[model samples]
Target: MDARWLILADDLTGAADCAIAFRRRGRAAAVIWGETAWDEEVPVLSYDADSRGLAEAAAAQRHAALLQRFHTAGRRLFKKIDSTLRGHPAAEIAATLAPLRAVHGHAFGILAPAFPGTGRTTVDGRVRVGGRPLEDTEVWRRDHRYETAELGAMLATAGLASRVLPLETVRGAGLAGALAEAASVPDRIAVCDAETDDDLSRIAEAGLAMDAAPFFIGSAGLAHALAASAPPQGLDPVRIGPDGRGALFVVGSMADISRAGARRLVAEGAVLHLPVTPHTLLADADGRAGLAAQVAERLAAGGDVLVEIVLAGEPDMSLGLRLAHALADALASVAGEIGALAATGGETAAALLTRLEIRGIHLADEIEPGVSLGLTLGRFSIPIATKAGAFGDADSLVRIRDRLRKARTEGSLT
Candidate 1:
């Protein structure tokens, strides 16, 4: 099948989650980042721009360059943003519109950044999480770059014109006409309000039916809507079962959800937990080698292991990146023995996979709303699950372990 969709994300977890949406629908989607090149034959391709932590201008430049390189005829575009609006979304959206307008006589974008399964919803052009406004959430307080969570105000800050489609209009019968009319205005973006998967599906259908192909901008929720509406590719989806060896889980995120999940799994005596400080990870060669040997020995004995970075408190942005790379380096040697891999945090996943020489992941299933199960595309083909740090519950890691075990025993990706 020809390439039909191109998804560009600012980080690794976002890329995997969105691509897996299509994979679940048998679209043969694959996610690639870092040095991995594009594959034209893949029906759906998700590319991580790795600009989540960059300044606004740098992030915009990175996305603009990626679009010029990857955007092509007959391939629809999807811009994946953080559900909580943590990254350089406004700049990136403006960058996307400029290039698309230059290429296609007119360019229009429908922004619906809601993933209901993960408790993120857009109401009145503002984001709400778990019945609370985004500004009240811990994530926004800790990591948000923008001063406001108001969608139109955020876009306006970047000098982009935007109109909010209230829930009333989105659910109305004339959504398609409304979207088309909004698109006729140059550089205007439609910020849609949606609270559920069904609401997102309605927005997607309306956008798809327009006379011109609209550029989609949202989270995995929007990706799922588009994937469900996609035509059959007639290509056999890749089915991967697990190997008998033990699984290796890496928790490098500072999110409470991730830490709670790891703690629950360890407290249950399901796996051996090895918690190391950032100092230990960045320690001398012998120290790092010893950690690798211990991990490898556990996996070689068919025992699961959990390797986590224990920070005293939240490190600054630079330290977080350094810590992830250090953790990746410590685990590089045992990467080959990993029968199954699960990682939390996009930067952590990207660093570890790149060190392991994995080119991409052929997605298979979504273990949860923000978690994706897939197999490595290059070098090693082990079963892998990728999850964003803030998503899932205290039992998320336990569920991941159980799911990996079941997949190995059943010899299917269910």
Candidate 2:
């Protein structure tokens, strides 16, 4: 029987980004969060647990519950964690393994969270972004829950035993045997080092060669390798309607990468750029309506629009959530005029979808490495694309806009 895959992520962008790995390989994949119907024969289902910001205990509990509901003996499980190790990876990994271990008599986790395409690599079980240790990077300094950048240490703090599989061993011919030996130890996780896509492919092959199913943990890099190793399933593309209305782009992240991409879009002059502050969104109803009307008018005239949240002075972390919600509300007011949607951050995408009453999205194709284009399946059915806050380069947003425009014109987006 063909192996069914389950990708459980902490947020919407992570879920869609990973699911597109399977979709690109011609396997049927869909991303859903909250209550939604599922097709048993879809082959791959990526569910967003939406627990990135939750407390450690709460995140673990949420993942455990979702695993209990969706996990089965035959399904190949991939726990999607942030490439930079931002979320509760240690806790979520343990929560995922508990029920599996109970049923299989033993379970081992094979984690490789390196997405080399995006400059994230694991060397000697330590995560590095661009050539710097993850802890020393801006991402970790801004929002990190772990005490260190070492994978083994993080796992140990979560009460889990782990061993690092160095790069030499991973790249050697004895990889499969080494992984088998590692899996022999009950509840022991083997954190493999990978520096490139080929390294990830080797790890995927070795991990899949095991007799019993081992829980796989990684980012889209590993997912792509695993999906490639699976049996061929012909692509099932969805038809995207012609773009007669304007597309909407929402930027809700304060990350430097996201800001750079938005700036590039503005410089390109391909879309109408509108910047709003949290105070304006929260206190100015007339201002919100007026802004929405302007966006709607632009969209109705077949022009693309980009709306970004800009802070006035010093950063106010407390206003992030409120500003996100306000942006979502403003977008919802003009949902009818929107022909397509592209959101940069996970939280921003989730809020926009919820406010628009969209239940789920059927992932169609990937516009770029981390950018996923799909069709909305619920209340607001339109072509949409999503990318993580910190995944792409300055020109990533411009590429997305061009791809969507090309897909719409060619009438073969799916």
Per model, how many backbone clashes are there?
A: 0, 0
* Candidate 1 Cα outliers beyond 4 Å, as residue runs: 1-3, 231-237, 240-242
* Predictions in order: lDDT: 0.87, 0.88
Per-residue lDDT of model 2, residues 1-414, tens digit only? 257898999989999989999898888899998888777788899999988878899999999999888888878889999998887999999898788876676789999999998899999899999988998887887788888989999998789998889999999988888888888777889999999999999999888878887889999999999988877778756876577887899998778899999999999987999998787799999889888998999999999999999986656765766787888887787888988889998889988898899988898899888899988988867888999998899999999898777666665666
Per-model TM values vs. the true structure: 0.95, 0.96
Candidate 1 per-residue lDDT over residues 244-295, each given as its tens digit:
7789999988888899999999998979899988768776778788889989
Best by TM-score: 2
